[model samples]
Target chain A: MNNNETTAASKASKPTHEHTHDHEHSHLDETELRVRALKSLLSEKGYLDPEALNVLIDTYQHQVGPQNGARVVARAWTDSTFKQWLLEDASAAIASLGFTGRQGEHMVVVENTSDVHNMVVCTLCSCYPWPVLGLPPSWYKSAPYRARAVSDPVGVLAEFGITLPTGKSISVWDSTAEVRYLVLPEQPANTEHLSEQQLGELVTRNSMIGTGLPDPASAVSQ
Target chain B: MTNNSAKSNLTATADVLRELPDIPRRDNEPVFDEPWQAEVFALSLSLHEQGVFTWTEWAHTLSSTIKEAQRDGDPDLGNTYYLHWLSALEQLIIDKNLGDAAQLNKLHKAWDTAARNTAHGLPITLP
Candidate 1:
């Protein structure tokens, strides 16, 4: 092999630690280490090889990520009975729409009644219900989210551009072994007669995550 | 998946496991009728295998629990946390012991298949 080719090959064959030495003393936390190891395994196994990376990227773009959280939104908007059922047992209720556990399986749907509003957090670890929702976004699992969601949930929601009314009591649900929760937000005003599909289109993932209210106009714009 | 590739991956993983710190044994443990602890132990290993966490991280986490327990005057090592995770999985696999094992094996095989397919520029679909 030529000198350049030899150098490239040598680089390719080098141990991971040798290349990672710069970050060795960086006090890599458990989460970081886990992410690194996962990436390393993926890369080494060619699951993250260059050509595979492209396909993976495409898959991520086309196949993965959140589907429209519209049905839940629509039910809240029009069908009061369906909304009640959703609040009672979200997993079974959502399954009716064929959206039962795609990613987040362990789910408990909480209602935002006139007196109380509900929010969710996986404080101990990111034990999300992936059966309904897809894999959690990076932000959901971040340390800031885990810490802040419990201590100052209102403030965190504010940061996400969501604000509750003064009289509304926000109840933060800590997802544990028995259940994972989704926030069944109140129906937004306007578009009362909109079709189920249209209402479903309006239910953004953010609303389900208790970060935002549904916006039919926004869905229409999209 | 090629046998060589699968073998190499297993070797790499085993090498990592070999480097892992020993899990300290506990004494006068709660004598449960079920093999709950073993199941939790297996789940932690499975999670580690699935790349949810690394050996070093798990080791450190367990170590911290041990340290905290020692400080709190609780003599028991923090193996219970892992034991709990395993028990959860075990309970999940109840009445389907063979099925659970098969599922684990399937996951391993899928990982290998994905790895091979990824090498060939094909997307690996996770089961």
Candidate 2:
């Protein structure tokens, strides 16, 4: 077709798509209004309070997250008996460390083996092992992580810069009723001669969650 | 002298109030007054809002659960209370309608916003 003819044809098609797009925009606005109304109803029945809500939000941000997980990882590295106990019964074992029974009650610990590795996701929601590990990271609670982690764990982990060896199948545990999991990462190599405190330094929060293993070099540098 | 120290003292008092703990009440007596309790309370309330359980049920469950924990020799009040609170929240979230797959999508988005940039706290953007 000639250039003008082609241009005329494209112009005719553009309006249809634009009309659909505008329709979708308004549809989304209406949906948002419904959701807001529902949420407001939930809030009004004494179900939600702004002050309490702020406190919950603040606790997750300031008190939980990497810092809390680090404590669990450090303890696991320094104490062999505790590591065994943690793998066996995470809740009771964590209680032994004076960090028991919080947001993640139905606690289970997954041990990383040479042939198989494990990661956790709460596909239904952001169910986490909060007592031992503290609040989950934003990514952990994300749908992309929750949905993809089960079906394509290696792929998801790779996005987090974690690459598993060939022939190693990744087992993704879905946190549901009566069972929540924490990952017991493999201890770092060449740290046999290090003191317990030094070993503890090698353990990072990511290691405990099985996303990434600890780097001895960074630990020593810090 | 010239009222500067007085002003400094007032500022210090405000700081103290900000740092004040939310204690668990026993016959209106403050028992587990600690910063952590506030965290537990907030989590519990969030779960309740999500409809995990009614407040009455939560109160009953928590009281019994705490007693059991104490019996088991885990007497750390703040931690134990939080443990119960967490359980209640989890159950509540699980129990809610959660409605369709679209609702799940909305929750995922909400969680992402809440969890990220969380250096501050839970965002006001939660639906």
Candidate 3:
């Protein structure tokens, strides 16, 4: 074998740490260790197809994330008819916009009014609608979040930088195996002149998750 | 026709997934809480799609891994389901001659070092 081929084979076969002595003090979290171990082994064997992986990741990150849900929210915010339809039948309304499949086959849209604020959680497991929301954030799946959301919705919201009105009653929805929820946050006061697209830009994943409120002032009008 | 069929499709998929462990798949949507969890899930699916392993084999291995964990005092809480999944994937890959333990252990250590040096929220680029 040629020198280059020898080097390549050895590089693939050898442990990377043996070549270096700099990591004397570092430690890995158990989950991180397992994930890396599998990923590396898969790559070494050519089983880790980067392109396929990217396609899956990009699909969630771009094509089927909060942005899709943002469009739904924006449409509902600007058009009363659409809003009514969404409230009445969210699955059909969302699917009509070409956002349907998998975790999003069933959906429920709950509106936040002046009197009642809505929050969502999955006490048993994180059951979120992936079609519109992509994936649930790590915090949503945490033990503290699952337990505390039911016991203290207001306090949990406060930790997420949300402070609802003192009089507004908080209604927490525990997402389960049968139903998924999407919160329709109240539109901010100054966004009346903004177009539907512009309004959609103002809606964030957290706001839709009911852990945050939209920052309309930051959504530059075009 | 499409709308009615779409609703039926939901029932179809939901019914099948209802039997899967760790997933409350009746009427509930699947929620992947972490990026790594999604990545691992996609890896398994892609592997299956490529005909590397049959669905039956994948399900059997995964269920056994979870069962083993339960035997070892794992609480069977929903959170650790994916951890067991990763374990099963590793074992299956090794058994199938797709990879070896020595290489995986090396990579694991390398990743630990690299991750330690990287700042929070930034992606870990293995060296």
Candidate 4:
């Protein structure tokens, strides 16, 4: 491709890929530098303890995320007794799994059954269960999704490529700061032999948020 | 401010968070995409703890910063959430007389110098 010369004298400049890569590399470095300076200022001022900051960052960076919620879903799918507990006292049931946190203090697990589908939205702001879901995706926080999810959940689910059974009702739960709702996505069919761990692998972050569903067993086995 | 008081008041900031204008968050903590995002989060909380500005002022600063960004055509697609947060923190510091633009500018320059002198793989100590 280099053999074909450009008419605008652009060949004199280095290849575009290399030029752009350097630009991005420096851009990242600039952001890194800014962070380092900010850290130095806070450290020098003695306002923030370095250890505490690391703990806070690590909590979100490593620990809290959708996988924890996946485990809860898997447990409920296989154990009817635990499922009853989860639906009734989600915070305690979830805490039993060692996913306890203030962000998940008052959780309510809404089951997705054959008769109905569930979705959650915070109409006023982004109130999400972080301990279970990590951060809300951009669309979840966007005004359109927040507004439309409540007004037209069926349409919103369609937008997400979900086509519910013709008569399956859709229910939208408006989340609040005091109570976060987690959807226990319907267990996929034909997975009777799969273990709980295997079932968890079928779950995606969106499934817990009710924006998506668990991958079908056959699709996941691939 | 004493260390003991700061520790006691950390949870209190969570309540103050409720007063801020619409912002994306998970749990009570602000949602962050990068380490710097979390850094800004902790920095603001720390500043609040140290009495750099009251939580009411923090709320006002963040709300106004967000409004300004919206007015300036920030599409509010959620990617630039932290940039507005950083702006709010800086604005509060300057407005409250805790720091000024000149000091922040110098901090950035010093960091740039430190970063330039450091080897590619090494940690850049502040200049």
Candidate 5:
């Protein structure tokens, strides 16, 4: 082989760490190591299709996520009729808005009023509203969150740096496989003029999960 | 504006996500913290398609694994979420008689060798 072809051929044949330490060795976490191992095993066994894996990852990583839910929250906040419909029959209202699928088939949008605050958790497992909220965060799926959200909603909120009113009664919704819950955080005081899209900018992932409030419209408006 | 924003979320989502200092995000989107998390997640779904285990079976295994970890004094901090997921997958593989413990271990070792010998950012390939 000529000089260029020989170089290219060797590089192609020996694409390994032993080639040269041109860059720092990247460390893979323990779970990551195991996952890679398992993935390879499955692929070798003809069970894991790389194309199918990419499709699933792309769906959650890009196409579906909390952004879908945020838009729903913003619309509910701005449109009174939509809000009413959402409260009355959330699944239909949300699906009407085009955010409907697995883990969101039976949605329950709980309102957070001055006298009451709502928090959601899955005491049994991470049964979150995936269509709107996407996958549950690590914190949402944790044992502490699942265990304490029901018994002490306020305390759980405090841990998240959210302190509700001492007099306000907190309601902890334990989401199930049959139904999912989303928190419609009270529209902040000075957000009447914001457009639905602008208001949706205020809605955050945690707000829909009841662990946080929407970003104040004033912040975005300013 | 509503129609436009719904169709395009990266910009607006990024703005608000920046304000929440405590939450982990990439490109202003809430996503798996590591590649492994995503792989394991999709692995479960892919395996289901392979009929390795039903969704109900997978969920039950995962839930029970979490419960067992909790009973064993696992703090269940954010980190362990996917570890339980991996455990569930392993359990299902063995339970379904797809592979025994020894075979799985051998596969794991092969990957480890490939990983050790592979260059950073290069695909891990087994001979």
Candidate 6:
């Protein structure tokens, strides 16, 4: 494979990748710098407090995220009593685990069965339960996702490489500021003997979003 | 603004929070693939907290920016949401007299040039 004698596809793909990456990277860098510049301006002008900025960043970065949601899902899979309690009153059940705050004041838990699969979306905006699930991925907030999820959920799921069984029913729940929804993905097979922690290890953020599935292979590999 | 007027204004801002959803985000860590998106998010929130602008005004600015982008033939894919956010932030800063448009433009150019010259995986410092 000589660099000068590359195939046409390879040659084209390389530049496209580089161009796209460069464009996006530069845009991101520009925004980051602008924010930094703005911070300096505000700080110098005495309009902003540095300590508050750190606290906000620290809270989002560490104190909140998907692991909290994973714990709740894992517990539901292992404890029938708790699962029933969760289905009846999610806010209380989640608060029992001590993950409650802004964006999670009202929560609705939808369970996935063999015949029915649950998916979550916010057609108008991104409304996620930040206290438990953490911040959302960039794709979740994209225009294509917001518009497509409600209109063609299966197709959208397929685009994420998730192919459901032909006869299975798909339900798309739209989240709003008043109520946030979480998808309780069906537990994978052959994990009956596993502990709650072990079950949680199998859950991915995408699985909870219904854009992905829990694989037994991941558990084995780890 | 008078104390009563300010109180009403703040209540209107609070009502906007109740009615509309701002800060489009998901439930995993690092909501953005790029670091700059988070920076923009934090900057807006920080400014709002410092009383530079109400969240309601920021939300309106961002929503209008997205709407304008759509009118201009944006395909409405989710990827451009943050671009609207950045645009709104810029406009708000200028409108509020918190930042100089000329200075921002200068810094943007400097950052772009610096980023282009820097190697991949290295920290980009504005010259």
Q: Scored by CA lDDT, what does every candidate get?
A: 0.51, 0.55, 0.72, 0.69, 0.74, 0.71
Report the alpha-carbon TM-score of model 1 versus the true structure: 0.49
> Candidate 2, residue A36: CA error in Å?
11
Positional deviation of residue A215's Cα in model 3 after best superposition, in angstroms? 0.9
- Write candidate 6's Cα lDDT for A1-222 as tens digits: 234334433656565545434433323355566766665556556766767766767777777788898999999999999999888889999999998854324787889899888888766556677878887777786667766566566656766778887677777787765677888889998888788998888888878887778666766765
After the best TM-score superposition of candidate 1, give how far the Cα of residue A149 lies from its true spot, in angstroms.
Answer: 0.8
- Estimate the lDDT of model 2: 0.55
lDDT of 4 at B85: 71
DockQ of each: 0.03, 0.03, 0.14, 0.12, 0.19, 0.14
Q: After superposition, how far is residue A162 of candidate 1 from its true place, in Å?
A: 1.8
Q: Order of candidates by TM-score, top first?
A: 5, 4, 6, 3, 2, 1
Q: Which is the winner by TM-score between candidate 3 and candidate 6?
A: 6
Candidate 2 deviant stretches above 4 angstroms: A1-58, A195-197, B1-127
State the TM-score, rounded to 2 decimals, of chain A in model 3: 0.75
State the DockQ, from 0 to 1, for candidate 4: 0.12
Deviation from native of the Cα of residue A193 in model 6, angstroms: 0.6
Q: What fraction of correct interface contacts does each candidate retain?
A: 0.00, 0.03, 0.25, 0.17, 0.30, 0.22
User: Clashes in model 4: which pairs?
Assistant: none
Better of 2 and 4 by TM-score: 4
- Residue lDDT tens for model 5, A105-132: 3788889899878888778778788889
Output per-candidate TM-scores for chain A, rounded to 2 decimals: 0.66, 0.69, 0.75, 0.78, 0.78, 0.78
TM-score of the first chain in candidate 5 relative to the native first chain: 0.78
Against the true structure, candidate 4 has what lDDT?
A: 0.69
Summarize candidate 6's per-residue lDDT along B58-78 as a digit string, tens digits.
756776787788789986556
In angstroms, give how far residue B57 of model 2 lies from its true place: 12
Question: Model 6 misses residue A49 by how many Å?
Answer: 2.1
- In angstroms, give how far residue A78 of model 1 lies from its true place: 2.9
Using lDDT, give the best candidate's number: 5
Q: Better model by DockQ, 3 or 5?
A: 5
Candidate topping TM-score: 5
